[model samples]
Target: MHFVVCLKQVPDTSEVRIDPITNTLMREGVPSIINPYDAHGLEEAIRLKEKVGGKVTIVSMGPPQAKEALKKAMTFGADRAILLSDRAFGGSDSLATAYILSSAIQKIQETDPIDLVFAGKEAIDGDTAQTGPGIAQRLDFPQLTYAIKIQELTETTVTVERKTESGRQIVQAQLPALITVEKELNDLRYASLPNMMKAAAYEPEVWDVKSLSFDTKKMGLKGSPTSVSRIFAPPGRSGGEIMDGTKDPAATVATVVQKLFQQNIIMVNPLAKGGKS
Candidate 1:
């Protein structure tokens, strides 16, 4: 089996800043790290590769500096790493990003024949969570999102436990499926000394727009439909009022009720079906 894990380099949220004029991230001085969710996805892939017998390939699409993220992944025991970078791919929305990444995966599949594709449930910078499903749709693969664990894996099928708002769900999909994983899926392993050395010496294969077959119309800003109008910090919250109920409980209750009525926060006949006379 061959596993392909999509990785991303993102600004550390704690140090992130938005441009006042452009309303875009100011990456000039911000430090970057692997997307936390994607780190877990990569860890799961490497664990599966260790348990069974297979290869793990890490893929990322970003600027040239993204190779640093790929190198970090390689230290975690991935068999190969590929970076898809090009000016033509700049300013791409999730849809165009999926197109570019899916194209690269297809080219990779030519020789390796990938069985499973993995990605984080969502990117921190852009919490949209649409790119993974978009890639699966383009590849015509069954997509399983919010995966928490791999219950089973065989030559022909995979069974996974997914996290949901209500609780959890176990789903089965055929081979050659795509899975978007949450951070709860697995704990990341530290890189071994030998692997660290290898990563330091490693150079990920870089592919530009010309390297892959792409519709020029669907490559960059031209292909993106969504745009950010503004980005600003939320307003600060005001402190709440406190009442002394310990001294006079009944009077305190009455006072609270009277305040609610005075503020129009509660109606006199809120449960009444008809209008108040």
Candidate 2:
């Protein structure tokens, strides 16, 4: 069994700020880390590899700096890491990103067959929840999203508990499927000393556009059908008005009740002598 986990590097949300001028995220001086949900997915992939006795490979598409995220994933005992970094891939939307990642995964499959693909349900930065399914669609693989737990796995099939609004549901699918996992699915483990050392010394394979067979029109900003027009903070809440009940307590109460009734926040009592049904 061979598993390929898709990972992403994102700005630490705690430190994220929007630029007043550009109306975009202020990334400078902000630290980057692996997308938290993706970390859980990586953990699940590692656990599955440990159980099935196979290799776990990690893939990420980002700028050169994103290599740090790939290396950190390696510290979790992933067998290999691949970084898809190129200027041509910049400013890609979810659709274009999925295309680039799927192309890279196909290239990877040419050398080593991939049996399963894992990704986070959503990225912290985007939260669109479309990239993983897009990859699955392009690869023509069965997709399972919001998977909360792995119930069972066999050579030909996999059963999972999928999170839903009412409750989780059990879903079974064939092998070579792609799954997007929820953070509640698993706890991330601390890397062992040996794996830590290995990660420190390891360098991931970097692939550029020339290395993979991909349509030039389906990459970068040109390929993106949508773009963020502007990013701004939501307006700050205004101070609440105080309803003082000192001067005329009864009158204040009546005024407040009337306002509530006018706004339909509090329905008028039909049983009241003067109230209409």
Candidate whose TM-score is highest: 1
Model 2 agreement with the true structure over 1-277: per-residue lDDT tens digits: 9999999999998899998999989899999999998999899989988898899999999999999999888998999999999999999999999999999998888889988899999999998999999999999999999999999989988899999999979999898899999989998899888999999999999999998987879989999999999988889999966988999999999999898888898896789889953
Model 1, 32-72: lDDT tens per residue?
A: 99999899999999999999989999999999999999999
What lDDT does candidate 1 reach at residue 229?
A: 73
My TM-score estimates for the predictions, one after another, are 0.94, 0.91
Candidate-wise lDDT, in order: 0.93, 0.93
- Candidate 1 TM-score versus the reference: 0.94
Stretches of candidate 2 exceeding 4 Å from the true structure: 238-257, 266-277
Residue 86 local lDDT, model 2: 92
What TM-score number comes out for model 2? Answer: 0.91
Residue 169 of model 2: what lDDT?
93
RMSD of every candidate to native, in Å, equals 2.1, 3.0
How many clashing residue pairs are found in candidate 2? 0
